[model samples]
Target: MPRIGVYNGFDPVDVCSYCIEVLKVTAMGRASLRAMPLTHLKAYLSAYGLRGPSHAVEKEDYVRAVLDARQSNGCLPRVNEDYYRRHSIPQPTGERPKGFLARMAESFSDFVDSLPQPDLSSHAPPPPPLPPRQTAPRPPPRTTANRPPPSMPPRPQATPGPSNSRPAPQPTQSNPPRQSNPPPPPPSTQRPTPQPLPIDNLLTMKPEELSALSIGVLKAILQHHHVRIPQDALEKRDLVDRVATLVEAARAEKEREARARAAEEEAELEAQRQALEEIERKKKAAAQKDDTGASEGQASQEEIPVAVPKAAAHAAAKLERDGLCVICQDEDANIAIVDCGHLCLCLGCSELVMQSSKECPLCRTRIVTSQRLLRIFKT
Candidate 1:
């Protein structure tokens, strides 16, 4: 008889189905009821409250599996790309809500209020104000010659001081009556002088973002306050900061790129050095071959004392033998720079080689004609 076996391959851990059902119900808290399938809709019913614990776990696991499969299959919907950004979901870790619904409602209200109101595209413009009417000028009142002068009250007299032992006497004074016509208001002292804005200072402001403000409002506000920045200044300030930051970032990035390029050049130089070493190794190998292959008649145990570096040996010999510029071999030497040798064909080579390149092909010394080079041999 064949042995009985449980389900095979990708066997999920056994979980109570009843427990899963309850979990599925909770996890589906925000799922749209209208779009949910009939079978899922039936399972979500509150009638399942009386179900057993094992059944709930199993249902949750099943729902979890379904969601997992969908996600793995690359079909999961993106509900909130911007929802969880740098500052989104600012809740602290290791926290649990006392009540979920209340929190949700409050968060939702705050988020909704944060959005700007829609423009009223249908509103009509207000009519322009009416013009003022013209009025006739009134004539000044005529003065009467027979009019009696008004009586005037006497100014208050100072109270007399009493003797040291005598009691002080008290006197009563009535309060002044209020007048209907008040004294003419003090003359206006304000000067209507128009001041020119310092174009140099205002030019420092980010003009790109200034288009939002009216010229009148900008000029008025810029006046009377030089340091206290307005809230709208943030809009302009952000652009300035952005440009500055971009420039800084660009500089940093350029420096980084330059460093990378320099590192690459250094690596390339090292490779070239290795290649030259290899070439020298090959040359030494060839020289050894030539020495070994020499016939007995031509070969001598006492080798000729030739300079190891053939090129430098030639220059040393030429300077010693000729006592002149090896190039022109001119006995008459003149026109020299300090430290550098005065060996050249003529004044033409002196100008061309000295001024044009200034580098000696032999030692690679940079020669400055004005600085002058020493004549090791006067010739």
Candidate 2:
């Protein structure tokens, strides 16, 4: 069996030398190897007998391993060209038969080349010269013969001197006798006034009659009666109803407010009168007490010293001590529960309360967090 090369130019030496040169150029920064895709780089590494991590090998590390392998081995490992040719079919060795048309064409070309010998030295003649072309003469330009010259302007005539023959018409009666202002221009023809539409007539008027009236005139009438019409009330009947309802409601509200203000004023006056009467009654009681004191002057002086009770002082002291935390009853209540702002617990108890219930103990308001009081003495 005859052997055939599967790859025609399978030069292992040239391939290894080219890969070595590429790696050297890449390492010198003359070319970039990092830009190559991962799959291509892995294939390149495997072909060169350089092993890399199976998974999660970084691009830079894989490229470095390839360079290192090239340095140690001096070149990329060669692939077996003979192994590639093992499965290739053998090429045929016998000569190919020529077609009939091809053989005929070859024979005709050979015969033509042998017979071609034309003698043009005695038979050839020089070419004749061409005749010169003729052209027509151009026509002459037109002339303007009879155009007239521009005419000169006429000179001004001298004004005629006022002749003494006429007497100047006697000054026209000296300013035409003043004319008496032309009798006041005959008084303009007056426009007849439009009659005002009464409210009662408006209520009974038909829609067609209302539509005939101008919108401006209707608006003016409504304004005179202190009525407010809605801007969107464009139709004639809508305008009438809107104005009437607004005016009636306004009048009723005004009356109601006036009555309420009057009642309030009356009540205030009555309270003031009662207060004055009470003041008079207190004055009368003090006068009676003074008369009794005059009858017992010595006992009245002694009673004045004992009027303030001792229990009131004890109650005020107890209230002052309540500012301490109710839970510990030792530290001053300084932490305020959030959302509720209750300062009934100290900082320590507030944390415990947040962990346990996350709510204000007094108001049961959900406690999102708490804040410390800078001034615990403040109410």
Candidate 3:
């Protein structure tokens, strides 16, 4: 029996059937056979029972066999070239199809045609028939059957002579006694007077004493006296100083108006004092700057000397505490060799050195015995 190869889990027969039915590949065409790899060519030929004399088949033989098989099967469907050329029309390039728009327009027209139309005839009732024309009734004929007589003229009466007769006087009644009105109340004896508030000595008052007063009272006093305090001066000391200065200035101006020569002398002295104070303040500020620069330089120089030994000692102690074994230098030293008394090897390095040689790595002294040191826990 010939060895049959399977393609895509389907036996040779199924693969060929699927390719012909689904892929529409003719058995005679080498195009479909060439679609797969060359290794699958033998399988393709075996699928259609197109085996050669030998078990092994060449690609050309397999292709020829496929072609012969397709030809023996039947004729292929004919291509209608003239029919396509006559009926088929090519759409303009880049233009969208008008079929969808035409369909939508048709549907919209159908919907409009299906809508209910209003009945104009039945919308309004016909106007009522005009009422028959009628003429007004003629008035009755006039007659003078009940005519009233004309009114008679009034009769005249003769005038009577005047008589000398007077009416008698009515008896007079006595009048009631009249009461007098009471006298008006006497005028108020005394007028109430407003007492003046006591003024405190602002110049002598301390900041603590000024702060004890309510802010509203202090503001009222300042406003009443017409003393201008700085809007930003919300602190008690600032308000007290401003009030005192205003009062003193007002008093001084009054005195100055009274004594002009004395006022000039005082003004000159005040100006000189202010000038001296400004000069002293500048001098003190310069001295403070120089002192601060000198102190900063001295501190920096002093810190350097004190810091050097502390850093050096700290580094040395750290090295002694956790330094690696001198032998291997890869691990901490936990073993001290006897006779040499040098703790220079880790547990691993000590074991290795002991087995290889009995000599200390640091001193080169003969190591008769090795001692493994227990790790000491420091409090």
Candidate 4:
């Protein structure tokens, strides 16, 4: 008989369906909805035949509702490239609502749109078309021969004789001309101010990205980086080139300084190592010297210096052969008495002996100067 297997709630088909739904909502639908402005989001819902959120509803709620609708509809009527192009959603100039003020403005705009608008065409009728302007018929031009002579009234000859005596000169009043104010100066043309770019990641921006900015903005960037713009660099391309050159130079300089600092640190470490080695060598030499002094004292105590006139020559020869200084007997005789020409003092004892006696220890002759000597021995 076959063994019965226990049933678990894991189903591949159900998991696959859940994954597809998640992809549709999150990867495709929800992201686009969240990025859209309130107007565009409503337009998107209307385009897909889904109920758009009310003016009072929050933006997140609207986004979630849209996502749910898309999921329930099995991803049909999707917010894909075709839908964007058809409905003109996410217009190039449109930006998503940013801060509190922007969100409030978006909410207010949605509320205004929700209100019923009066039909302007029916309420305010268009003015009737103005009747065609009536123009009088033009009369025909008259020739000199057909033209009528001017009519003249008969002049009163009797009244002309008494005109000066009868008519008193009326008082003539002259009026001053009115002064007019001068016209205002024409409006001056303003240079366009640079606007900050949406992308603030200037450090990692490429040359092409910088080139896309306007000349004013490029200058602003150069100013921000404290890079000097050359007097002759007027064009946008020239500014971009200048910026690239300066940035590269700065980077190179920084790297060079870093390398110099590292080299200095390494030199300091090397000097410290040499100093440590020198100290260790001195310590070892001192330790050996102490041991030798102890052994020499022990030997001196064991042996007694008798009056040995017969073996004096043999003892001097033995001291020379052993390369021991006569005064110290611990170090090598590496210094020579100048006048007497005897190597009997070690470098350490030579200074002390000369200061005390000012004469050679072996010959007892007046010493002029002491000189350090090097000895070579044949194997």
TM-score per prediction, in order, is: 0.18, 0.22, 0.15, 0.24
Candidate 3 wrong stretches, greater than 4 Å: 1-213, 258-379
Model 1 worst lDDT window (10 residues): 80-89
**Where is model 4 poorest over a 10-residue stretch in terms of lDDT?**
370-379
Question: Model 1: number of clashes?
Answer: 28
lDDT of 3 at 230: 69
lDDT of each: 0.44, 0.53, 0.51, 0.57
Candidate 4, TM-score vs. the true structure?
Answer: 0.24
Better of 1 and 3 by lDDT: 3
lDDT of 1 by residue, 19-116 (tens): 34433444453244334443453333312222223444434544443344323323322332132222223355575532323344465578799999
Clashing pairs in 3: none
Task: Give the lDDT of residue 51 in candidate 4.
Answer: 69
- List the candidate 4 regions with Cα displacement exceeding 4 Å: 1-203, 224-232, 294-379
- Report each candidate's C-alpha RMSD, comma-separated, in the order given: 33.1, 31.8, 41.0, 32.3
Judged by TM-score, which candidate is best?
4
lDDT of 4: 0.57
Per-residue lDDT of 160 in model 2? 48
Q: What's the distance in Å from true for residue 157, model 3?
A: 95
What tens digits encode model 3's per-residue C-alpha lDDT throughout 1-379? 1123652232244432223431243432567666644435444333333444364356666556545554233322223223322333234457653432233355567879999988787755555455444455688998879968868886644643344232344544444445577888999888543331224365456556656766556765555443455678968777666555544544453453345444445555655666776678657755776878667754554355322345344434433435468877655554565465676776567667768876788888886644332221112
